[model samples]
Target: MNLKNTMLKITTVVAVVISFIACEDDFATVGSSVIGEPGFNASLYDDAMISAHSYDLPAVQTNNLPLNLLGVYRDEVFGTQEASILSNLLLTSENPSFGTEPVVDSVVLAIPYFSREVLEDDEVVYALDSIYGSSPFKLSVYESNYFLNTFDPETNFEQAQRYYSNLEPQIMSNINPDVLYETESFEPSAEERTEYIVDGSGVTDTVTMAPALRLKLNNNFFQNKILDKAGTASLLNQSNFKNYFRGLYLKADEVSNGGTMMLLNLLHSDAGITIYYKTKVVDATDLDDDDDFEELIEVRRSYTLKFGGVRVNTFEQEVPQFEGENLFLKGGEGSMAVIELFSGPDANNDGISDELEFLRDNDWLINEANLEFFVNRDYTTGTNLNEAERLYLYDLNNNSILADYILENVGQPNSTSSAANRLHLQPLTRDENGNGVKYRIRVTNHIDELLNRDSTNVKLGLVVTQNVNLISTYRVLPSANPEVQRVPGGALLTPEGTVLYGPNAEDEDKRLKLKIYYTEPKN
Candidate 1:
């Protein structure tokens, strides 16, 4: 079958593994074999090397059904008389007509890295596939309730979620324990099982990976401009425009030459990993010929190729880098900060963007940005909201730019008045977590930047923000009496005396806690 048939869209080849990685690091040779060249001459009469390749590529079954879906399924099967029906899909397909036992050798699901977005009329939805090709699936918007509040629907899972699956027994020979699933299902939370997740009966399986990305970049135009620079991060300033005209340098170093082009690399999170293949002759006559072979081919016996994942960028605690925060414009005149972000010709051929390399080369000075937006309590009134709009359009570059990038049709609380359109911001107080932190992006603002990138720096700026994550926010225990409710919404979030982690006022995966003087959106 074609690749699109499977999940992750990875081809199951009886072929050697293929990893996507990036440029490498210095290597050390522990021992050396000294070959004495005593006028040694060896030559083949009629040199020829031919090979055949093929193999039964392994399948990726769900190892752990999925943490979030486990919760989803548990919630799905609630109040049903035969909860065992929840396990129906987990059962392998026996002959559909004969009514066979349908005991599958195994079943598996991908790990849950995404959460569902609730839709109109209370529909729970998730991405069916990926927005970016590098990712396996994208946004799958669906109804929230299989049976919300006494409502039940027939033929679940089909309407619940959409993903790829493989079932051929022969093809699943060597399964990836990390990606494999136990082919099991369970029920809702109860006194007995808090999360309703039963531990896997099988021992934890280890995963094997290779890191190496194949890279390719070709641009004859503007070769002179890029000619101004050259080399990997280590080769710094060596790949000048002159040598580029001469050619023969690593492709990554070539693009960093300062031209407008995207590059990719096969980045291996691990080092010294290589992809190897086992070969067999497609024609038996070649094996028996003994003389110069006639028919020989290298057929892949396993699609389990070993390439690598991109090595994560690492930075010291003191490095000058931009940090992220959530901005919830409740409004007043305040300052906002902006930090520069960059990208480079990728060393990996995974065909994704690379940014960390640019920072290291630029003395860690990222693109310029700041966190100083005005906070207006209610735009429905007067000058307060307009003042916040003024700073959002801070013309530091003086490019005659409007804050439109800030308040565009951002898939969220769109502005209602013409005044909301012209608001700008300046920083009042940035809770500097010391090492390096910045900004207060409204959660609405942050996610919007992540989704769209064409016009503003919101998405483009993420190259530097990738390492930055918004920490969890807790709406501190609020007091009931009116006397206790008089604190600022933002004040209640960060207890004045205590310190928070990671530079941003909030911790990982959460931030920009809004203290509501008005109605808060229901989560």
Candidate 2:
């Protein structure tokens, strides 16, 4: 059925169901009078046929994302994943003129990490967020020659060009042989950086900035490319500059047993390359002298090239094929679970399963439906391991949010609480020691529609999400499964993962199952 018709039917049924619930005091009598019965009895049904399997995702589209991931992350359950970034630099202004005899001093590239300021012992300190691992990793920066097009030429310049996570090999092949910057061992620090700046008069001033990945780039590269090309066709505008210099490729390599992974905010205003140069300027102080002699002195000046235009994230992941009883869910070209509900024999040659047909044949009013995923603590228990805060469930066929999620998030206040949309997508439960327990997701509306309305029973996709509110999806280039062309965008932003008990889990009590509460009129 069309989505509009389905939504209208769902809305009308929900309104009727809500009205019936509002007058619950007379529901039993009303139901009894209509059916010539005594009353209605509510019961819990936990046994329902469900099947779930894990699918390893192919390289997904990763261009022009809000944030980018860099470094290597190794998980005991899902193996290792290495992330890198390639971006085009843009001038702050067009057709810039450098004063005569402009000499390059130094060039620095800075990218901020997700962090927040906190007070510790009455002293303000910065705390890094969304950073994984502790060991150092090797980081290398190279000048890329690959041109990232804003529009796809194959599509007659009508569609945006897409870059996938597996483009590292292609990008590396197109880079300059000489590395721009490299570090044998690099790790993110939470401590604020203090810089001492000196003016033309040799007066030093101290400046404090937030924590960021600051590195000194090859001065000759910027000097020859930027300073030497001032007012030339190459530096005339952003378009010409991008075609001239292309971009930079930040590559990460494993240096130790474990490597650090950090989410970088490259779009920040301060995140870019700054070129410090010396220019000759007339000394005003000397002009006021009695001799009225104007002397030229070398003054320090700086020009910044911000990261703009097209930016793409490249990932190299080693995810093994799933073969276990438990399901593994990892983000960023990792893995996801495909869930099937009410899987049983359809003896009548109908689409609806016999088990679901039985529930429909009996006039049962569904009150609640929940799918609980128990965490396999044995695999996820570690001091250094980080688990996903929430898991998102959606219709895999349509690539849309479930009805329950839409209903629960309606009119939700815009607050900072992590517990938002708790009714439908509950956050991961934790123990007293902060270990993960399980995630219970409500799908009452979805299940009701499947049984009471003409809504199709579609397969559900489950994945780890950074935020529950971000329901947008991004296309998965060369999708692993034909049915799954796209996955949740929030899932691609996170590197965290978890192993959950699947339908065929060895532990009967912990096996994933749908629990439904319903009321039926007593005969």
In every candidate, how many clashes are there? 130, 0
Per-residue accuracy of model 2 over 1-523 as CA lDDT, tens digit each: 4522331122213234345456843121112223322475555567778989887888888888888899988877777789999999999989886666888888889987778999999999999998988888999999999999999999999999998889998998899988989998999999888655556453457789999999999998888889888879999988899999899999999876789999887889879998888876666676335554467666677788999899998988886866787888998889899999988768788898877776676666767678999998978987355799999998999999888775643233334244377768888998998989899998877887887775798999999988787677877886435867888877887889988999888999999978765667667
Q: lDDT, candidate 1, residue 190?
A: 10
On residues 197-268, what C-alpha lDDT tens digit does candidate 1 reach at each position? 111221223442221111111222212112212222211322221122221111101111111111111122
Q: In model 1, which regions exceed 4 Å deviation?
A: 1-155, 162-302, 305-434, 437-523
TM-score of model number 2: 0.87
What Cα-based lDDT does every candidate model obtain? 0.19, 0.81
Residue-level lDDT for 442 in candidate 1: 25
